[model samples]
Target: MIVITRYSVPEADSVAFQTDAATAVDVLSRRPGFRGHRIGRAADDPTLWTVVTEWDGAGYYRRALSDFDVKVQAVPLLSRAIDEPTAFEILAGGDL
Candidate 1:
């Protein structure tokens, strides 16, 4: 599986950002080959949230990103410093 991590950074409007983020998560999770996903936020760091998405493979994510709605919903949540997100290959796993 391919693991993609999107980092949410601070914004002028935290409420709006988070609200949009929640919706995006719901939408993306329904895409094909999206096996599973998780949302992470730090208690002491409001600007730091991680969206860990598990895909069937990198190709699945690439194909999903082609959807206009998905791109529209996702772009705003990304930090300016983050032109792109990071992806990893899952070597092992257990119960969540």
Candidate 2:
């Protein structure tokens, strides 16, 4: 399963937001079934940020969110993500 979270932050808050995003990734990476994650800023809009993560399955992703460390370190940051669907099932893709 894949999760993509979008964050709309002001330029002045970019640094702090990135720090929080990094901490979220770090906390999630330590959870079971975590696959990988990446954080990126929109090329067209610097204030737009994203955190993309892949997991073994949807269950793993949900469980990870309930973890103590993740709750403390990641949830706060994640809460700032745009209010919209974040999870998805890949329909088609190719490895690089």
- Whole-model lDDT per candidate: 0.69, 0.94
Clashing pairs in 1: none
* Residues 1-96, model 1: lDDT tens digits: 755454556656567656766777777777899887777676877876666677888888877777777788764554332446477878898996
User: What TM-score number comes out for model 1?
Assistant: 0.75
User: Which stretches of model 2 miss by more than 4 angstroms?
Assistant: none
Tens-digit per-residue lDDT, 1-96, candidate 2: 899999999999999998999889999999998989989999999999999999989999999999999999999999999999999987788984
CA lDDT of 79 in candidate 2? 94
Worst 10 residues of 2 by lDDT: 87-96
Clashes of each: 0, 0
**What is the TM-score of each predicted model, taking all chains together?**
0.75, 0.96
